[model samples]
Target: MDLNTTKSLVTSKTFWGAAVAVAASVAGLAGFTVSAADQITLVDQIDRLIAVAGAGYAIYGRVVANRKIG
Candidate 1:
């Protein structure tokens, strides 16, 4: 595979791992706190995470499109 494809794969994997970790941490915290206020904050955090992931995917697509594969 070309450099861009390789980089994209690695980046995507890392992003997914990080997302999972964040989700797990949030779940654990919610289990302990069990508060409505905390739940709202968690929802906001989830929205931010979705935006970040979307941006990452967009960047990956741009990089892959610009790369020339043989």
Candidate 2:
């Protein structure tokens, strides 16, 4: 991606906010699972997807930085 796109993705508040939200959701899932077993299935699946996307976003910054350094 271009520099602007790289900067925007890495520095954007929305991106990091979503990452934090996903992490919190996953953390809550453990304690909430027993009570809401039915809904946990779908929510857990969605959380996994969001986590993957969030990981990719965070990694993009490192990959870009590595390219510049190496």
Number of backbone-clashing residue pairs for each candidate, in the order shown = 0, 0
* Residue pairs that clash (backbone atoms under 3 angstroms), model 2: none
Task: Give candidate 1 regions above 4 Å deviation.
Answer: 1-33, 66-70
- Computed on alpha carbons, the lDDT of every model, listed in order, comes to 0.63, 0.60
Q: Indicate the worst ten consecutive residues by lDDT in candidate 2.
A: 32-41
lDDT (10s digit) by residue, model 1, range 1-70 = 5655544433454555556567657877878443555555655666677679989988898787966666
TM per prediction = 0.48, 0.36
Error of 1 at 38 (Å): 0.4
Span of 10 residues, lowest total lDDT, candidate 1: 4-13
Superposition-based RMSD of candidate 1 using all C-alpha atoms, in angstroms = 9.2
lDDT of 2 by residue, 1-30 (tens): 474555435445556556556665786886
